[model samples]
Target: MASHVGERMSGSIGVNILLYSFYALSYAIPGGIILIHSLGGGLLDMMFSMPMSRMQESEADYIGLMLMAEACYDPREAVGFWQRMEAAARRQGEEVPELMSTHPSNQHRIEKIQSWLPHALEKFQTSDCQGTSAFADAFRRALERGTQFQTIYM
Candidate 1:
């Protein structure tokens, strides 16, 4: 959320500068040329901004997973949640190319979570959650079972 806010603030500043520039140039440039420039600028902004937005989203996801594991909660549940989200999207026939979207696709998120699970699991194991809950037991079992790509449906 902080990243999003920062991005929005920066984007707003950029737009303001563009708006001021457009106002100054309006008297010198033809209206048709100004319109074309505005459209092209908007397209370029979107092309740059979409990937940054997706990166922010992925960063948030990674932070959330780490925080959850640090809190001794199961990071594997993150994968399951995203899996369900992917399933829901599929059911709705909703698909967007990653480049055009503001967020990473669910499958992409799942893959990243899987890749980071070993670190998160290590954090979970070292945290004060030992013998604290059923989730702890499952974590142990998963470690014993080899942690990668294992989904824990909640």
Candidate 2:
């Protein structure tokens, strides 16, 4: 929402006027210098934003895991999900270095999920909900058959 507001504001006439003025002022700059400046600015933005994005992704994973467990779904499946994702990424050659990516590696997510599993399991165990829903049973069967859960979406 904040980003949407910022975008809208930047497109307003006053902001666009200021932006155009700056562009006019910089019009005499050499194309090579402008390209280098643009690249450097982009690199700096990535350096600052990527780590924050990755951290937020990991935090979301943790929260989702806990929420699912609290709602009586098995937390162990979280680790399995990451493992499957890692396998898919490897097969597609989609893996990126952690420092350059906006999300943690699947293996890293798996390890973090495993570390948090015990607590999530406790939440599941203490919850009033039963653990044997149709979906849960089906998921377990799929895992037993070595089926990719990605094909079995809700």
Candidate 3:
């Protein structure tokens, strides 16, 4: 909802606006500068962090597959979910969500997901069929938040 204060303060307001104009400007200008700085700073951080984050995401996906399998859901859903995510990304054009973007694009990730399938299947079978913790167990635990991974394929 666009309230009166928000509407009046948002656009380019003149000096004769109100007594609070100075206060608003004082707050707004620095806030705007800070916002801009924060973005640039975030980009700088991503320059170093993106590669590590990508690795983390891949690790997460691998573990997430194990968790899904252990929970009796097919691990193959990772591929489909990633595909849909890539499609959604394409539809979004240049305005991708920043906070949601902590790793490589779905296009780059799909192949990795495909390659890891065989191992994941093996792990699942060994774990589920044998009743042992299996090799994927440690990874599953390490990727504690794997439950939230959006798989590339269903």
Candidate No. with top lDDT: 1
Model 3 agreement with the true structure over 1-154: per-residue lDDT tens digits: 2143443344314323432343445565757555545564465445434444566676777777767667655568889998998888788784344444666677767888788888777766656444344545777876765654535332
Residue-level lDDT of model 1, residues 1-154, one tens digit each, is 4567877688767766765676667667668557847675666556666777888888899899989998878899999999999999999989787777889999999999999999999998888886567776787888976644455532
Instruction: Estimate, for each residue in 1-154, the C-alpha lDDT of model 2 and write its tens digit.
Output: 1243354344445544654565565667767457545664456436655666777788788889889988888899988888999999999999999888878989999999999999999999888775457677888888866655555652
- List the candidate 2 regions with Cα displacement exceeding 4 Å: 1-36, 131-154
The clash count for each model shown is: 0, 0, 14
| Residue 106 accuracy (lDDT) in model 1 | 95
C-alpha lDDT score of every prediction, in listed order: 0.81, 0.75, 0.61
TM-score of model number 3: 0.48
Better of 1 and 3 by lDDT: 1
Cα deviation of 75, candidate 3, in Å: 1.4
Give the TM-scores of the predictions, in the order they appear: 0.69, 0.64, 0.48
lDDT agreement of model 2 with the native: 0.75
Q: List the residue pairs that clash in candidate 2.
A: none
